[model samples]
Target: SRLQIVCWTVLVISAYLVILFIRFLNAATITDPFNITIDWHLWALLGLSASSAVGAPVIASAKAAKEPAPLQQITADGPRIDTSRYPAPVTKAAAAFSRTEAEVAATGSGVLYGKAAPADARFTDIFQGDELNNAMYVDVHKTQMFLFTVIAIVGYGALILNMFLTTTNPASLGLPAVSDGLVAILAVSQATFLAGTGVTNTPT
Candidate 1:
């Protein structure tokens, strides 16, 4: 319990730290930007700060009391698991949603996830029924993490593009404040999701 509390505290603090760093960077490094109308530094600071408020859940969820895991069920003979709804050879990365007896008897699990994997054989792969079925309030954690990852990649890409364009000439794409804001939102969102489950942003 104490360990969980510490982990959660760190998660919330991490969000705040990211917001603070962004603000500081805007203040120090971006005071002026080629005489633009709006001081984008300020915009970036405000937007990111608002998004960082998503850390509120971390402390709240952490301090909440824990619930016990479900125990085994008892039968006339001793203990028995009513896995009638579960399928045989359940050798999938994850389990399927509860299926009706009639449907299970007819369709089977193989019929359920009838789809192709990604060619790269990476996490990008999704079965046909993935989007159709709702597994959790959030889907795979990898996808959520990937959201921020894409944001970061785009952020660096913008900087590189700016450098390349400036080298060639002064005409190129502008910096992406929206991308930064998107990453801020994603960071805070992941923190909130982790807080709810008493999990930290630290990778599994």
Candidate 2:
């Protein structure tokens, strides 16, 4: 998610710079009253960046919907612990392994995750199981909402500044007056987003 956001921010900044360069070209050629127009390039940059910012909520929401509801799966049967129930090891490595080593690595008394089940049936606890099922979705929703709020605030502020710099009096402020300001604004936006990503990914 952090990578995606950074990529999107770079794209947005690049597009903005390109458009600003074009505007410079326009400003240089056509004189009088600083008539400026934001063409396709400007709109496309905004669209792509805005979409990327919005994608977090969509992805998380979709995942949340698809995940199975957490529940304690109870069975009517009891434990069947018998020495005869144990099966012979299929491979040479398994047959040679001692009892203690297997017990350490296995999920239960002796069964690794994503492998064959243990000889004795094990049941998961309600609290841990519930956390596993719902954790991602819960985090996704929270983070997505935060992302949207930040993007919206930052984007709108930048937009307002851009409009002021572009449409207002350029002659009074000189040729490159807005250039440094624009760079500063974009730098802040990217920095803040990167900081947010770090905060989000930090271990608790």
Q: Which residue pairs overlap in candidate 1's backbone?
A: none
Which lDDT tens digits does candidate 1 get at residues 71-101? Answer: 2344588857564442232222124534443
lDDT of 2: 0.37
Q: Mind giving the per-residue lDDT tens digits that candidate 2 earns over 11-55? A: 455544654555565586446433434344434434444654665
Q: How close to the true structure is residue 42 of candidate 2, measured as C-alpha lDDT?
A: 39
**TM-score per model over all chains:** 0.31, 0.26
Candidate 1 minimal-lDDT segment of 10 residues: 127-136
lDDT of 1 at 66: 26
Sequence-dependent TM-score of model 2: 0.26
Each candidate: how many clashes?
0, 0
